[model samples]
Target chain A: MRRPPRALVLLAALAASFFAVPLAALAWRAPWASLPEVLTTEVVGSALRISLVSSLAASALSAFLGLPLAWVLARVPFPGRSVLRALVTLPLVLPPVVGGVALLLALGRLGLVGRALESFFGVTLFGTLPGVIVAETFVAMPFLVLTVEGALKGLDPRYEDAAATLGASRGLVFWKITLPLAAPSVAAGAVLAWARALGEFGATITFAGNLPGETQTMPIAVYTALLRDVDAAIVLSLVLVAVSLLVLVTLRERWAPQA
Target chain B: MAPARRSLGRDAAALLGLAVALSACGGEGGGGGGQSEASRVTVFAASSLTQAFEAMAEELEEDSPGTSIRFNFGSSSDLATQLEQGARADVYASADEANMIRVMDADLVEGEPSVFVKNKLEIIVSAGNPEGIRSLEDLENSELVLSLCNEECPAGKYAAEALDKAGVNVEPDSLETEVKAVVTRLQVGEADAGIVYASDVASAEGEVEGVPIPAADNVIATYPIAQLTDAESAAGEFVDFALSKRGRAILEEHGFLVP
Candidate 1:
C-alpha cells in the first residue's frame, strides 16, 4: 500500500467537500413535510412535464443527428473536417444564452432559414413549442456528438470492413454492425444530452420565452418561482434533482460500459 | 498499528459530528463572527431603480457608523422570493405595487408599504425607429416583429393595458421575461418595437429610441418600498434615507414620478 500523491489527495478532499456542502445545505433547508403538496401544484407539474417531454425529445433528436455526425467526424476524412468538428462542438463552449440568441437569429421567423420558412411556408419559431425543442437540442446535442465520437474511435473498424466483405450495404452495416457495437456509448451520449437539456436555463429562457404551460420547463419554473415562492423553487429543484438521478440510475443499468 | 487505525476512525467520526453541529448552530466560534457582528443593510430593489437606489445606499453608509449597504437589483418578484426564504434584508423596493402587495401578503415586510414613485410606459424602437411605430395602432401590423414583456411581469402587464386602451390587436413576436430583454431585442433589430419605461430607453442611448406612449389613459405602475421586520437597525436606517429627499432626487433624475 502506497500513500496517494499530496496534490491528488488535496484535490480529492476539495472535490468531496465541494459536492458534500451543497447536498448538506439542500437537505438542511428542504421542507420535506410539504413536498407532496408542493409537487402537486399546477405550475410545478406543468414545468415538470415540459422539462421531461422536451428533454427526452432533445436527447432523441441529438441521437438521430449527433451519432451520424460523430461517425462522420470519426471515420470520414474531409477538407476542414477538424474545423467542422470544432463548429459542431461550439455550443458546448458558447454560453447557452448566446446559443439561444444564435438559434433565434438563424431559425427565428425572420432568421435566414426562418425568413425562408415564413416567406414560402408560413412557419414561425418564436413562442412555439418547436422553439423549446430547437434551443434544448442545440445545447445538448454537443454532448452526444463528443461522447459518440469517442466511442466511434474506440471501436474496431475491422469488424465493419469484415461486414462489408459479406455484402452488407453501408447503411445496413452501420445499423446492424456499428450501432450495436456502440449501443452503450450511444445510450451514454443520450443520457448526457438529457441531463444537459433538463438543467438548461439560459437558452430556454432566452429562446422559448417562459410561458407557463408552454416553455416553462422545471429550471425556468424554479427561476420564476424563486421570486414568487421560495417553497416552489425548492420543490422544483428537488424534482429536477430526483428526475436527473432516476434517469442516471436507469442509464447506469443500460448504458454503463462494462469491462 | 491497530490503535492508530482506531484513533483515525474516531477522529473522522468526530470531524463529521462537528460539521453537523456547525451547520445546525448557524454560527461558529470566531469563524463567522466577522460576518454577523457589524449590522449590515441589504436592499433588494428593482433594476429600474439601479442608479437612484445605489445613490441612496451610498448616502446611508456615509450617514451611519459601521453600517454597510448591500444592493440586489433585479425584477421585483425575484427579490420577494429571496426574502420569503429567510434572506436577511433590510428593505425591498419593487418596480410595481402588485408584486409588493404579493410580498406583503406573504408577511415578509414590517410595516405598511409606501408608494415611493411611479413609472410610465414608453415605446422603444431601434435607434432609427425604422418601423415608424409612432403610436399603439401601428403595432397591429402583422409584418412588424414587436416584443413585449409577458403579461405577468409589471412592464408586460402595463404594455398590454396600453395596447388594450388604444383598441390595438397587436400580436407580439415574442414576450420576453424582463423589460431589458424586450429593449435588447428591439435594439438588436430582432424586434421592430417594444414597450418599456422611459428611463430604460434613456439608458439605451445609442441602441434605442424612446417614444412616450400617450399617458392620458396609459398604465402607470406605482413603485413601493417597505422595511422588513428581520432587518437590523442599520438596514432600517438605510430604508429611511431612501425615502428621504436625496432618494426622491435620484428617482426624479431617472424619470420616476414623485409620489
Candidate 2:
C-alpha cells in the first residue's frame, strides 16, 4: 500500500531505460514487413542453423567436460585447487577475441599440439565446423563449471555417503544420487552456457574463421550484414533478440529460482 | 503472497514506463554537441588505411597545431553503416566505391567522393610459400587452405573479382571481416594463403609473402574520401589534405597506387 522511495524509483527508472532503449531502438528500426523475406534467405537460414547447432553442441560438451571438473573442485581438495578453479573461470573474464587467439596458437596447424595432430593424422581443426564448436565451448564451459560447482558444493554429501555405505561404488553413487539431485543445476547451467554460446562472436570469428554454412553463426552473419545491408542486419538482430528473450522467459518460468 | 506478487508486477511495469521516458530524455542530449566543436575533425576510414591515416593524422596535426584530427578505422561497410546510423564523423574515406555509394545513397556526403588511392588483391602465402601458391590459380588447389575477407568487405569483393577473372574456384577456409584478418590468418599459418590488399602484404613485414595477381586478373579497389553534409568546415580541409601530394606520397609508401 505504501509507495516506494522516490529516489530509488528515479534511479531504477534511469537504469532500466539505459538497458532497454537500445533494444527499443532495434525494435523500432527493424524491417518488420520484410522480416520474413530477410529471414528466409539462404544466408540467414544457414547462419541460424549453424548458430543453433554450434550452441547446442557447445552446451553438451560443456556439460560433459565441466561436470567432472566441478565434481573434482567441489569434492576433492587438492594442493592447487584454488588456482585450478581460477584458471577454469578465466574465460568468464577474458576478452573473447584473446581467447580465440589463444585457441589458434594452441590448436592451429602450426600450433604446438596442432602441429603433431596435423603431421600424424592429417587432421585440421581450423576453419571447420568442429573449430566453431571448440571456440564456443572454450568461452561457454566456465558458466556450466561455476554453476555446477556451486550446486555440488551446496549439495548434502550424506546422501552419497549413505549410498556408498550400502555398497554402491563411488561411480554408482555419483550417477544415481549426486547427479539426480544436481540435475536442476546442471540443466540451468547448460541453458546458460547454450545462451552464451549462441551469442559468441569474437572467438568464433578469430579461431574458426567465418565461413557461410559453416563458421558464420548468427553474430558473424549479423556483422557481415552490417557491412552490406543495414536493414538485413537489423532483421538478424531482431531475430537474435527474439531468441534471447524466449530463452529468458522460458528459463525464468521453468528453471530460474525466484528471489 | 498474491497481493505482494501483484504489486511487484505493477512496480515492474511502472518502472519500465519510467525508464522509457528517461531514455527519451537522454537521447536528446547527443545531437546538439556536434556543431559547437569546430576545431576537431573526426574521420572514419577503411581498416586498411589505419597505418597511413595515423601517419597522416600526425602530419596534419603538425601542419595545423590547433586542429585535432581523430580517425575511426574499420571495414568500409561498417563505417558506412555507422554514417547511416548518424555517427558524428566529419569525413569518411571508404576502401571501395560501393561503400561510398552506400553513404551517398543516404545523402550523408556533402560533395562527390574523390578517388585518392587504389589497392589490388594479392595472394599472401606463408614466409617461404610452403604451399607453392604462386598465382591465383594455385589458390584453387583444394589442398592449400585459403582465407579471404567476407563478401561485404571491399577486399573480399576485389578478391572475388580477381578469382573470377582467373577462373579460380577455391573454397576459402574462412572469410574474415577485413583485410587485416586475412593477412593475420596467413601469417599464423592457419591458412596456406589469403587474398588481401597489397598494402596488407606490405604491412605484414615478411611474416607473409605476396603473390602478385596478374594485372589482367586483378581488381583495382579505389579509396573514396568525402566530407559529410553536416560536418564542420575542418572536415573539408582534412579531406583536401589527405588528397594532397604529400598524402599520395604517404599512401605510396604504404604500397597503395596513386589514383
TM-score of each: 0.52, 0.53
| DockQ of every candidate | 0.02, 0.02
True contacts kept of each: 0.00, 0.00
**Which pairs clash in model 2?**
none
List where candidate 2 sits over 4 angstroms from the true fold. Answer: A1-10, B1-259
Candidate 2 TM-score, C-alpha based = 0.53
Error of 2 at A165 (Å): 2.8
List, residue by residue over A199-221, the lDDT tens digit for candidate 1. Answer: 99877766665555556778887
TM-score of chain B of each: 0.80, 0.83
